[model samples]
Target chain A: MQWLHAVPWDLLLIQTINGIVTGMILALVASGLTLIFGIMDVVNFAHGEFLMLGAYIAVLTIVATHNFWLALIIASLGTGLIGALVYVTTLRPLLGRDPLTTILATFGVSLVLQNYALWQFGPVARKIPEPFSGSITLFHLDYSLYRLMIAGLSAAIIGGFWLFLKFGTWGIWIRATTQDRIMAQAMGIPVPWVLAGVFAIGSAMAGASGVLFGPLVGVDHAMGFDWILRAFIVVVVGGMGSLGGSVLAAIFISLLEAYSSLWVSPAQAGIISFVVLILTLLFRPTGLFVATPK
Target chain B: MTLKDLDKGQVTRRRVLAASGIGLGAAVLSPMPLRYALAQSKPYRIGSEQPLTGVAALGGKTALVGLQMAVDRINKAGGILGRAVELIVADDESKPDSGRRKVEKLVTEDNIDAHVGGYLSNICLACVPVFTENQVVNMISVCLDTTLTTSKCNKYTFRPYDFAPSQAKAFAPHLVNKMGKRWFIAYADYSWGQSTRDAYANEIKGNGGSVVGTLGIPLGTADMTPFLSKISGDFDGLFLIFFGPDSINFVNQGTDLGLRKKYKWAGDGAVAVASQLPALGDKIEGFVGVDRYVPVFDPPLDTPYLHAFYDEAVERLKKAGLENAAPDRYVQSNFEAMNALKLGIEKSKFQGRADSEKLIAALEGLEMKESADFPTGDKLLRKEDHQAFVRETIFEMREGKYHLLDTIPWQKSEVPPACTFA
Candidate 1:
């Protein structure tokens, strides 16, 4: 009882808020990665680089225009274009290859993108000016309004994406492509074009996530690397290609991170997630949301 | 008959004369400058390798800023040895092998007279052998792993910053006397962190402070809950020896767990970075740490030159909109190192590669009074270990700001005598 009360309620709440904000962003990035992996059977290791490119675009746009919304649009579109180009140039040629080849190729692409970014930006952390600056007091706790807004926006985007994936025409095509690419192609669906479109949309989502995260986390070349590990863990724990699982796992991991920091320490929080991952693999390799192998 | 015919090659003499005439004509009438002109126009090159795109990018960028600033200042002051310094910078990406390769490229291709900049201890350790092999002077700006100075110390490597043992020795007595006698240490499980923890533990015990517990977590850990929980029961002071983003995470979680209120927290220069203070907020209040520089130092004499440097740094940061940003120890250390290097160069009258060794030799006994730009006191760079015996400032965070509590002046301290070259 004493230990329970000893926990700093205010600090815990703040950290939880931070976690949720981070989790929402994670869900956005992971959703795109999971979608690419589901539809194309490609891990798309460069997905994080797409996010980084998005953030850099947003930073460049914001520096020029000083408008946040403009920056977001440009960042998303620019990332989508880059994603499509990546598919056409680097990925398209390697299609129908071994899974290991795809993974290794994507890893190489990621390295190329990282080095290109480093050469262009010269490794300085560029900050995107916050749109809604400062904080608001809620429940007698001061929280960054921008952070809360980001969380709300991320949730809305995720919900809209879920609805689209479930009911929309493109969503249906994506599912078909994921389930039976050969049959989908036999039915006269332009499979290659659909795959390219999916890559673009997925990479665009990652870009948008980067734009949203830029102001909160600051933009750096390595920001993509920082989140990629977590996104992989989130996707694994949520179940591969399971959008619902991704959402659930993201929240679970965030809450675990929040509560663990309250009870233990932040350094251990990462370990806890890995421990969960190991345990999940040991027991339910398909993750909490079990999915049939395609 | 065939050998004579070959030797008497009638067309060869005429062809050779014609080729020589064409070569002379091309050399005299070419659109581009001659080889001698190009050689005369080339600048003396200095090389630097840093983790420019990885986790240590910020530190690398800061070191670059210092290096460039020093180069600019030196150039403005009539240049080094009457020749302008040209810096050839490369990104090591925080990899040990990459760092060695980058140094090799710099030494072999760039023909750099001296090398500068190393943020990570691992990278520094890896590159030291390359520098030693090439007989190039390496002015290392950061990297606190004790092994860099002791076991790995080479004639070519000179560290401008105080090493781990000196930092530990500076803080331990203070922790025992001012804070408490029971100490708990939590550090990252890396060369830098391990060496720091070992040094601190030994010094704390030596200073009559008992180490109640010690915990080492892997690098890149985002959560420190279990480790913190295990040691939370009863320690008077907690010595945190983590760096970079890990330190930020630890302090935030430590605060959330109410660990700061229960025990006094002390950390190394990693925690002393002013940029990290805002992330810590009120949580870091009353937390004490050891650092090389603090903005709140009170000196008897106000040097205009120091004030100008401070004002310039503040202006540069403000223009970058990081004005309110906390001053990192690396940034301050780089500034001091630049100044120290200039002093060393001037004292030794360094003219070329041969003179760098003499400059390093002069650096061993050089001392400077802390002006506004640097802190007050004398720093003696030890000849044997190539480690600087510099003063460490003790500071406490107050209301999201750092306040200097005391200054530990440089004392001639012994290097870890047990360390030996294999």
Candidate 2:
């Protein structure tokens, strides 16, 4: 009771809200990663680079058209196209090879993308103009409206994805491929096309997340490095292949990070996620929402 | 037959005599003049090594710009020591080992008289040994780690900017008196961060303030919520010791969590970029940070040279389509350093690398005041430490921009007695 009273309630509430916003962004990134890994059994090390490309595309689109919504759409689609191209050109050759080989190939691709970005954009940070400006006041707390919008939009996108996966024809094929790739291929399903489609969809999701994140995080060549580790943690803790698990884990980790900083130091908050990750592996090795292998 | 033979022989003899006389005349005229001309026009080479493709590329690129600008200016003003100064540039890619190898190449292969541009402290540390071994003067523009001057100090390397310890000493008293007495320090867990924290803590404690807590975050930390929650309300101030993207994340997350509103925020290097304020918008307002450069200098002494530099930087940025990019003080510092190096070269009348060692000795003892560009005062290059004593400008971000709040001058008497050079 004393500890509860000792807590700064207003600050705690503000941090909690901030945590949820950060969690939503994390979930959006992890959802795509988990789906890709679950369906294709490929760890796209250049996933973050795809996000960077998306943000750059968004910036270019906005500059060319002056329509933010159009930029978001184009950026996501553009990243999807790039992802498809990567699947055909790089991932196709490495599909039946060692997992380490695939990992190394993706790492090489990541380096190439990062260097390309550096050469293209130079070293300066590019700011993404906020689509909506202003703050919403709630119980003496001033929260940015744009951040709240991001959280809401991320939630909606995740919800829509859930519905699509549960009901759509291609989504069924994706689920089948995740469950039994050989069986799905025997049943006249094009396995390669399914993998490529999953990769594209997953990459498009990442791209959308990037567009949404640009205003909050800003766009720089090194921006991908900042979020990729956290995304990995989220996917791992949420159970490697479970989208719902990722969302739950992201929120849980975000909340823990938020509350801990008030009692600890803000710098150590990132460690808490890893600690949770380790604890999850030790206790519930399958994660909070472990999917049964079909 | 006898008449014909006599005519042919006489003709051949006259031709040989004329040819011998002409050859002797040509030899007498060519040798001395060619020797004199060769001696008069030897090219002087200046080498630059920097991280052109990695994390420190922003600073390195700007420093390169300044180096190029200075070289162009010097050449346009009739070259150094009446010899054309040629620049040999190398990209170290932010690796210390790579930087060392590049410096070795610059010294052994390029045969440069002087070297400039070290954007990272680690790279600077790697480069100092090479410069010392080669006995070439190295003018470092961006490395701030104090150990670069202290334990690793050498005769050839000179730091224009104040080191971490000096920065901490200058900032601590002001923060303690003006902001609060209880402080929380947070930074990346690395040699650079550790040294900064140690120096800052000592200064803070010396100024009668207590360090409430300290946390060393790992590099590439994205989430700060957990760490923010741990800070006690008893703490009156937060000192962030981070740079680049980390600073931006910390400040934004700190604000979102209402930490900035709860306590006074202060730090070294984290909020030093002027462009960051506009990017941060309302988040960084009221946040006080210390830097070595401020756009505004005190009145009654504004020079056209300073204006010209600023105007040129703005124009170049605009031409590069960075019109909205914030003018960085670090870039200005690099520009100033390049100018100072040229000034040292002119003063020493250094002919080449042979004269560079003596020129470096002179540079270590040199002091400049009443320069057209530096109106506040000139930085004195202490021979003992090879460190420049320059003023630290303190600024606060207001309305998405930097406003000059104060200046801390670095005089000989102002330095602590414990500070010494071996």
Candidate 3:
């Protein structure tokens, strides 16, 4: 009872909001990765590059339009288009080939994009002013309202995407394609186009997350790197190629890291994600949220 | 070239491709130098390793610019001892393994006379033994890990700029007296950060101040919200030791969490480099820092030679796509490091790797005066540690520009030699 009283309940409560806010952003980023992996067996190393390009596009859009919302939309559309182009030019030719080639291709694309950003943007981190400059005090914290907006907006976007998958015509096409590619193709669903569309949708989600999270940190060529790593962990932990499971895992990992920071340093708490990643691989390779395969 | 698109009808793709290939081959086999007028004498090959890609690429890019600037100047002024200073640059890729491999190549394959660049401290530390083993005079550029000149000091390496210990000694008094008594140090959680934290912590305590708590975030961590949330309790100032993107991330996230309002922001001068000012914007305002060189023209720093150096650097940085970027300490150190090597070569009348001992002897206890070459100011490359001490600039960022506060002379900032090179 005395030991329990020693806990800083106020800090714990604050970490809850921090975790959820961070979790939502992670979910948004991971959702795209999981979506791509779900439909296509391609492990996109360049997913982070798309996110960086999204932030860069958002920077350009905001400069021209001065509207954060417009920047988000333009960034998403821009990355989605780029995603389709990449698939058509690069990924499409190597579809039935070994998956390692696609991974390597995306990695090569990542290097090109990262260097391209540096060459074009010139190593300086760009600023994206938050749409709102307000904060709300909670217990012992004065958290940014923009951060809260990020979480809410991320949830809304993810929810909307989920709904689209549930009801939209293309959504059923993607779902059917994911279930059985050959069968869906036999049923007249253009398999190549569906794969391209899925990649575009996933890339669009990643781009949106970038613009949403851009204001919190300086938008640079490598901004997506940290989040993408955690997103991969979440993708693995939530079960690879499973969108719903990935969302849950993103929140789980973010909350786990945040709450653990209450007792351990953030650096040590970060290891919690990797530890869980290893454990999940060892104990439940199908992921914590995934049903054990028969 | 794309500019050679004279006519679409005449310059077809095949013809254009053929012309481009020929031009590329001509440029590669016999590259032209527009700056220097030197004899046909064999050049002094200087090896440089910087992160041309990966996380620290920005700083590494600027560092090469400085190294090139110095080499150009040296060559323009009758080259280094009548031979052109040919700089052989290697992209470290910001990894220790790659850095070690590149340095090994620069030494064994390239057969460089001496080495002139190393941007990241961890890479520098990793590559130290290679230089010592190969008996090359390694002039460190921007790596600020204190151990380079202190605990892990090496015979082959010479740091011709201020280290963390000197900076901490110079800045700690001002921080304790002017800023606040209690501080919380948040560092990049690597060799450089860890050493710099200890240096500042020791200096702060010595100045009758205290470090309340410290946070160590891993390098390249873009989102520090999770770590930064734990840094709330009570602290007068947040002492940061991060550079490049990591610093940008820390300041932005820390400010977003109301940590900026709660605590007085002050840290290394790197937190507000001229290139990063555009990214940091107004968030970095009022942040005070100390550095060996800032792109400022204040009192003692506003020398004619520095202006010359500054003008050239500004022009060159613009050419490198860093528009409006003033030469940071990385540029300054690399420029001076090459210059220091030149003086050593001249002093010893050294020719190549065979004259390594003579070069080392000449460089030991080297005294650099304020000039176009050493624009930062007078420095003493102390014999014991081979670490140069220069005037530390204490400044505040106001309206996205640096305003000088007080200058700490090298003598005032000097810590006793703590190295015995093996």
DockQ per candidate, 2 decimals: 0.14, 0.28, 0.59
lDDT of 2 by residue, B142-163 (tens): 7777776676677788876676
How well is each residue in B243-312 modelled by candidate 3, as lDDT tens digits? 9998888888888788888899899988888778888878898899999889888787778988998899
Candidate 3 lDDT at A278 equals 99
Native-to-model Cα distance after best TM-score fit, residue A157 in candidate 1, in Å: 7.9
**Residue B195, model 2, lDDT:** 77
- Residue-by-residue lDDT tens digits, candidate 3, A1-294: 899998988888888888899898999999999999888899999999888989999999999999999999999999999989988998989888899999999999888888899889988789998898988886645788999999999999999998998999999999999999999999999888889999999899989988998887888877878888999999999999888898899889989988899888888899999999999999999888989999
DockQ: which is higher, 1 or 3? 3
Top-scoring candidate (DockQ): 3
| Best candidate according to TM-score | 3
Kindly report the docking quality category of candidate 1: incorrect
Off by over 4 Å in 1: A1-29, A50-164, A182-197, A200-220, A230-294, B1-44, B223-231, B276-283, B300-302, B315-327, B342-351, B354-360, B369-377, B412-422
- Docking quality (DockQ) of candidate 2: 0.28
Report, to 2 decimal places, the DockQ of model 3: 0.59
